[model samples]
Target: MTTDQPVRAAVAAPGGPRPPQDGPDRGRGGPDRPERDGPPAEGPPAEEARRGFLAKAFGVTALLSAAGSVLGLLRDLLLARYFGANQGTDAFLVAWTVPETAAPLLIEDAMAFLLVPAFSLALVLREERPTGPDPVRQLVRATLPWLMLVLAACSVIAVVGAPHLVRLLAPGLADPQLAVTCTRITAFTILPFGVAGYLTSALRAHHRYTAPAAIYVAYNLGILALLLTCHAVWGVRSAALGVAFGSLLMAGVLVVPFVRGLRATRRPRRPCGPAGDSLVLIPLAILPVAAFTLTRQAQVFVERYLGSGLPPGAISHLNYAAKVSQLAMTAAILIVLVTFPVVARALAAGDLTAARDRVEKDLGQATALVLMGTAFLMACAPSVVALLFERGAFGPHDTAVTAAVIRVYGLGLPAQALIGVMVRPYFSIRPVVRRADDPAATGRTTLLDWYPVGAMALGLLVTVAVGVAATPRLGALGLAAGNAAGITAAAALLMRGLLLRGIALRLPRVLGGQARLLAAGVGAAALGVPAAAVTADPLLSTLLGGTAVILAFAALGTALGAPEVRGPVLGLLRALCPPSPPAAEGKLPHGR
Candidate 1:
């Protein structure tokens, strides 16, 4: 597929045609293979092709992500075995918050939110039989330098103020000096992470997905390797070093692909004037997004701050539980990453129908997937936690705490998935004015808007209030509850905003599917709990209980006609055992 084609159309069908393999712009082959040569495929062929491609892409990504997640789980297991939930672990977690918080702002979801739309818009404008210079290149040149400068400045601030920052984030810490040292080491990651995020945005804008998707795997592998090799020398601080080195490794993985993408799209420079003015809209767009990101990240701040005041290891418990809960969340996010760019590009081109269709489809499928995962996780929380992290310093007591927290967090998985899906539409809605006479209208509007900001702010307030009130009495469980509540409220507001903006969500169908999914989940839990009770070993219990839950959910879901279950099951079958091509009319079949 050519760069000028809409991203949706490019991946819309499978086995259609493949693009030239030798072009300067040719990206590394992975999940998103090029379409077939010749005219675009249409009708059922196109639809089936798209579905097959999506299935393959989703499968490949999920497999790789699951690998990374396993490594992440192993990292936690080792940490639990080696360090336990003590002052050192708590201190490392506290210091870890810098990257955790900054990630959303610099290179994770936040950057995706701003840059996807910006890059999509740039792509759209560049394709418009240009009257002057290339807007995409112009936007990149204008924003990248300043973005790097800001990232550098933040890193310096974080390094210099590490001690003060640690005090503010975890005032009750038992070892402030140790945390400060860890914080300083982690601080250096901000710069490299920013560079990685920028490169990721650029690649995604060009509709390249493989390299960006592999980033986390690369990062986790780096950390896992470093921790194993250097733990004896640096102790817990080795984790901090792993973080910094991993980030640089993450950035390094994308360099060649990003440069190739840049080279493919490179164009002659033109003087900045009306064409370049659209570049200013990027930062403007980033502001409200940045605010929304900060508010979302603040939820973490609230959790950690309140958790710090609780008994020692409260923060670590929360961290471990969150990792287990996030596995499902990560799956939902991978789906979003694939679909969001298509939605953004559609909206940028002013095709609301396409954008709306994509959003609704993504929302339903992602929601169903998360709900099923939540059921499995919540039903088998104890077994799951124990199987993954119940070795070494992590005993039954620690397992119990983490399991309880995971169950509470399971309540909010649907809301978290929905929030991720719902937020994309608002970002994808570009302001287009019909009056051609207006000189000020540069074919785009500022990126930051009130809808996302207001929705997120309201959510943040609820999270802080609930967290503050419940932490003293209920401890880490309270923090989990607060997070669930805040995210649910935010998801609701965002959904309502979409409705008000005239984006039809087909509410009745969506709600019906969800109700059925919930029923199936409940039914699954009913069977799974007993199956688990029959087993004495944690690993065996998890295997038995999880299998029972998944099978029940699948049977009930198919009986209830849930698309989420049937679609994937069928897709996987089709992918694994494809049909044979038709024989020639005059020729006998091979068997005959």
Candidate 2:
């Protein structure tokens, strides 16, 4: 027993424990075990644990995102069950628009853009001289007081002006009651997100992003549960209450972790002046950031305005389609956010070569993924929509409308994805400009400050033009067309920025593979379109034919040299249909 204790100790170590003594190798579990000749068991796990900082950080972000997306899916499904594409649902959608838009602006997007890079630089600096002072603590201290003041002022303004904002949200609406109600409900969303924004930024800066992000997943799940219970008991008001509850819960969850992270890190040094004085300058910087956020909000409000003039269900249809497109976009560029801060820090340190290499690799992968998705969606639009969203209150008319919109959105899938890729690098570049400016002068470039503003402006114009031109004749297709055109223009502008900056994007030599993918997709579409066209029942034909086409395309892509097809294909095959016991190739080395 004493002799075996050493073996047990080795087994309990980090990697896969030692092979079982009870196995066929039981007789070989002697004192002079194979431990000397064989590799150490902990080696693999140790290597995995020794991942680069970004991988560890991003792994957490991805897991949280996946969880949040799942929760969101559940919430939407429940919402759909309770309220199909109808007037009440449309109103709820409009009301939620402010908070929904506010999320990217106030919480995820801005915090991610600003905080991650700052924190990354701090981490890198600490690495250079482990015992040296961290500049971030000072930055954070200076930034915090201003964050609170700005958020507080905004909260007050939002509550006071909720009424007018609602009217602005749906300007085309003739109903005064509808406009007023939307504003009131949406106002509650503003403060919670504002609070969540600051806290989450702090959390992410400390590299504790995963736990905080999970808070959002929890928030969504809570909303889903509350909405279901409330709708059954009290109806639509419950849904609104669910949104408010979720936001508050999100704020609380993020706050606790954020404060803990702050305490763990040393306070930033304030060498020159009073900390209070630095706080005053923080809001001045925040003002432009706030304007940047509000401008984005204004663009979404425009879309809501256009949507309101349509049939009662149109707004809901547009939202649902937009959601689907965004999910695909999210999956494609999920790595971008993770790498963003790393890139930012690299650029700030004047390691432009390293920054370019990282961005280029990430963009290449992103482009391939986006193009692949676009092909799939283009091939299987009708069926994909029918399969995912045809049940509950989503009937044939709803399916047809949503599918049309999704297909149009599909046309610009590559462009929309590249927008995320293009902008994040500029974010890194912006900081360089900020640092170079006179300490007393206005700190950032107007071009850097409002770059997204231009992209969004073009998108808004294209959307309006599409609505006007297409609504009269093509309906939902027109709306989608406008979106596609807008994203395409945005992509062009982004690429032009890259070119002007002399950032060359070397296209990956996946052309042959892509050509194969396109061919397979076309062949699958050829088979599916006729099957769908000939079927008397539109819904069944659409779903069945589309599935068949996608499967056929996937099979062909996999069998060929399509690298993109293999990953998802192998995953699904392994998951849904496991293999039977395999035949032994030969006797064991020692022989039976």
Question: Per-residue lDDT for 396-428 in model 1, tens only?
Answer: 899999999999988888988888888777765
lDDT score for residue 574 of model 2:
100
What digit string (tens of lDDT, one per residue) describes model 2 on residues 327-438? 6665665677656655666665567776777776566556556655555556556666666677888887887788778878877777766767766666545431122122
List candidate 1 segments past 4 Å from native. Answer: 1-49, 130-133, 267-282, 431-448, 569-592
The TM-score measured for candidate 2 stands at 0.75
- Residue pairs with colliding backbones in model 2 are 137-268, 138-268
